[model samples]
Target: MTTAPVIGPEERLPLGAAEADPRTATRRRYLMCEPRYFTVSYSINPWMDPSAPVSTDVALRQWHELKATYERLGHVVETIEPAAGLPDMVFAANSGTVIGGRVLGSRFRAVERAAEADHYRRWFVERGYRDVVMPESINEAEGDFAWTGEVLLAGTGFRTDPGAHAEAQEVLGVPVVSLRLVDPRYYHLDTALMVLTEADPTTGRRAQIAYYRDAFSLGSQRVLRHLFPDAVIASDVDAACLGLNGVSDGYNVVLPREANRLATELTARGYNPVMVDISELRKSGGGPKCCTMELRD
Candidate 1:
């Protein structure tokens, strides 16, 4: 069997934009590395119904599958240590606005999850990432973050707290749009929304969000009016397939293989949607987006 040669950090996988070319704006590069995104699941997830996490073989296979997809899309997939006790941690990656390859590792809000932060921090700094932002007062989970290039939306009253958002505003130096997450079931803002395309001039396409039902400030239709006027409301199938949980590589979305109808509709509308088997993962309350940590250019 042909094996992939292990390369140095500089030779890490690179995924700029999932679309054919999502970097139309004046980004530093047409392609770049986003190694700060990921996911994790084990037998310990409280959200899982009657089942436990996948088997070690299944878990490792899924991890490798996601890693391969991210690498194919041009991203550096860095595997972190699995925390048997922290089921929500697999998606953990170094959180920060990437400025010249410097990653700002964040402090997690939940004490149970905070212990895992340092693991990623050391990982980033050891790899030569400078300007790391470990906020003294702010604590955030990587899941609380979403990268839109225009705004960094953070959710409070859920896994993330207010202190983290306030500090992130100052630390990240970007507009911190705070939304009160209505319930804890949708752990973070990302649990509901993901940017599938770049900003559109006509309808502000990039501004359009493919989100799901969760406890948040804005009404679904109202959000559509205010944000994406020409938006696609996630169908029931999309919702179940990971309407809000999958990652988009220029509309070739990574969803549950069970969500073929959603994929077909998205494909008809100029998206190239794809799926991965996450039946076991979903039993634990996650899907494609839940599995990815996208660092787009």
Candidate 2:
């Protein structure tokens, strides 16, 4: 029942020059699924409304633009075939959390997404990933698990079970810091927080992140502040636009176009903000980060 111990404030090091120095972009490999079957046929989250109209064509176009943006920046982008009935398959990040070539597969809380876990696990196995595990506890993979290069920041209370935090730590061999989400709108961890710069022990670079503080419990907020003293705090307006649901390669940050204020703040912090219009996909409570699954190797 116990998870990894949360790092105390006394152990926290000062994050110097997080906003003063220019950020560096590290090339990354990401897995994304085409939105060929993208639609809001069911309501699993607060954002999804079955009564609303959906346009698969718009979703596909927006998805393509996002994929091209990644390639344009020299990041490797891979795709998985979208299943016909699985509309949310376009959100590849929920598939799994891959780190150091090992995959911790997802066990979705909702029955609608339960089948997605198998498909993602199959991809990992087929592509020669040897250490792929399907957890017994309910977890939504990267949807609730975000790697900060030092520890795994796991979320619970909406889509992921707290038990999954310990499971991930045991399987990934990384310390897990559990954060309790308080807002139903920001159900998944990705929606409320993003890693801007991963901790690099070799280079002595501290991890930098951006988050909506109100989305988390008070204790979790304190934990985050201790870990990342220089973390960017997003405003309510930008957070509502899913601004924190972004993909960052240290320097370049890809986020939703509606998050104009956040984009400005990222620029002030020496990070280039690349905005993309994913209004169509947002209907399903997803953004650039949701559609992307980092294949850390």
Off by over 4 Å in 2: 1-20
- Report residue 296 deviation for candidate 2 (angstroms): 0.4
- Give the alpha carbon lDDT tens digit for every residue of 144-252 in model 1: 6665656766666656667777777665676776666664556666666666655545645455456654446665336435755655456555564445676654434
Q: Cα lDDT for residue 268, model 1?
A: 51
Report clashes for each candidate as comma-separated counts: 23, 0
The global C-alpha lDDT for each of the candidates, from Candidate 1 onward, is: 0.53, 0.89
Worst 10 residues of 1 by lDDT: 24-33
In model 1, state the lDDT of residue 137. Answer: 48
**Candidate 2 lDDT, tens digit per residue, 214-281?**
99999999999999998899999999989889998887789998998998887778767888889999
